[model samples]
Target: MSTVKMISLRVKSMKNIQKIVKTMKVVSAAKYAKAKKDLLVARPYGTSTKVFYDKLDLKDPQEQTLLIAITSDRGLCGALHKNVSTKIKEEFAKRPENSKIVCVGEKSRGLLQGQYGKSFLGVADQIGRKPPTFLDASRISNILFTTPYKYTSGKIIFNESKSVVSYLTSVVSVFTLRTLNAAPGLRVYDSLDDDLLQSYLEFSVTSLVFYALKEAAASEQSSRVNAMDQASKTAGNMISELTMVLNKTRQAAITTELIEIISGATAAKKDSGV
Candidate 1:
């Protein structure tokens, strides 16, 4: 009986968990759809900017390097955050002394806190609670501009959404205003002024950040949806298995009770000579 009760309890608990997992899957699916739509709309801006920057033929700067990791505070989203953090860790390993990290989300900070705490320049939290906006990107870009630690060349690490169930960890190049000004291809532009270039740099940063945020957001949602779906399926299987066990145990218990009752009645009848 105790075994039967335990199995029954397990089945009930698993059913409840499955319900939560299904609910989470539904919510993540909705968010993924929106994120994917937004990413499609924003792709052009990021691509065009990247193409224009590439045409400048900018030389990789030899000075301090910056790394901006785009992640979220939330977990249970598969390897979305881990992918970005792992890439950043590789970069940091290469240049531990010169690399500085600007974590666009708290997850990166948390992941890299122990070993590379000193390398973190700033962190932006409360990300992914809502869809990322241009304002959010602008705020993150401002951290780069206002921070005392300056960097000449950098990379933005993020997870790029490929499909409903897949993503690619990608890196985008970044250059400081000074480095951009010194690009060999800058000679092609006849009369670009300092103020104009500064504005362009600021805009570029914001655009890049915006693009990364959208990609990361979409990837996170998709990963989360898939994760929850898997969890729900596993929970469902466990519930079914446990329920089966409970039924078998219950049947055995009933069989034993009936057998005992039959034996007692037969003994009484025999003793009474009936």
Candidate 2:
């Protein structure tokens, strides 16, 4: 039976849940602001690198490809992680055997580690626990450069935030030093050499990864803000509905008690001939 006490309890629980949701929304909003600010600063550096590569029109001769999938360890942010995983799956479909994956969060590692375990070169976990720094990106790039696996072409996959409620999964193409050296456009510059190109490659990878991390962080935070906002609103609605139900139940009980008392009093008066 639906009673006033039960309904009141449900309403109290809903209120508590709503409070938590609101708090989460506030925290996410602050995080989103910081992430967005960082992203703005990183955009120019990352874009310039991509533009330089585009002008060179470099192409890899081999089919080997590498992918750095960026995501966050924490969940509760909509499809931020799933989108990256999906993009990786699509890439794998195109080149299943010659592809390698470097997962940059626990979420991606957990998602792809099952079937793509063999394809994984490394996993970078606990990334979203704090704001990403250039040093952090350098560490990841160092790991990649040290690995025995070689790739002609590579991509960094991450979420690009548009608004608090909107985001797009994006990819940044990368190339090896060999491919850069082979570009015909590079012949115009007589000052370049193998060592310089290698250094540029390392710095380029680090910058791109740093940019991607900032973007993913911003997107994740925005997505979380939107999610928590919606959750808080839903909880508010539930609390309102539960409150109404409680009031109706309590009134019904009171009305029933009053009717029983009136009936008993009338019967007694009639029996006593009053």
Candidate 3:
């Protein structure tokens, strides 16, 4: 009886847990859809900006490099932050000793802070609490720009969404000081004066940052949904197993009672006959 009761309780608890996990899976799926939509909306502009940067030939002293890693504020997604953190550290390791760390979201901040100490320059949390926006990305880029460090170039590490439910670790380049801005004759278009060029440069940075943040959010949601689905399945399997056990125990108890009753009746009849 105790075993049956214990199993029953366990199954009940697991059912409750399964419900929660299933709900989360649904919620994350919804969020992922929204995030993916936003990312798709903004990706083209970011891609164009990246192409523009690639065409520019600017090589500063490489004196100060920045490593911006996009992670998440919360964690339920498996190895999402850890994979990005590992990529960040690997990039940081390959850079010049003067490189600084910039983390987007809390997870990367925590993971890199202890390792990099003061080298970790800036960390932006709550960036992923809502679906990413152009304004949010702009604000983050502006914050990085305002930093006292004179970084010539930057590398952004993020998980790029490869498919609806898959992501791959990727890096985006930032030529903070574009050579075209400084040279009037070499400017691709005469309409872009120094101020206009600067503004466009900032926009480029923002766009890139925006892309990274949005994609990371999508990937994070995908991972969360996948994890929750697995959890729900496990819970369901446990419940089914326990239910089977309970049913078998119940059958055994019924069989035992029938045997006892039949034995008692048979002994009474035999004594009557005697």
- Comparing 1 and 2 on TM-score, the stronger one: 1
Off by over 4 Å in 3: 57-61, 178-196, 248-274
Clashing residue pairs found in predicted model 2: none
Name every residue pair that clashes in candidate 3.
none
Candidate 1 local lDDT, 1-274, one digit each (tens):
4688788878888999999999999999999999999999989989998997889988987789999999998888887898888999998888788999999788888898888888888999989899999999999999988988878988999998999989999999888888988888988988889999898888998899999999999999999999999999899889888888888999999999999999999999999997
What is the lDDT of every predicted structure here? 0.90, 0.89, 0.82
lDDT of 2 at 261: 100
Root-mean-square deviation of Cα positions for candidate 2 versus the true structure, in angstroms: 1.8
Relative to the true structure, candidate 2 reaches a TM of: 0.93
Write the residue-wise lDDT of candidate 3 on 184-248 in tens digits: 34466556566777777787888899888888888999989888988988988988988999899
Q: What TM-score would every model get versus the actual structure?
A: 0.95, 0.93, 0.83
RMSD of each: 1.5, 1.8, 3.5
Q: Could you say which candidate leads in TM-score?
A: 1
Query: What's the TM for model 1?
Result: 0.95
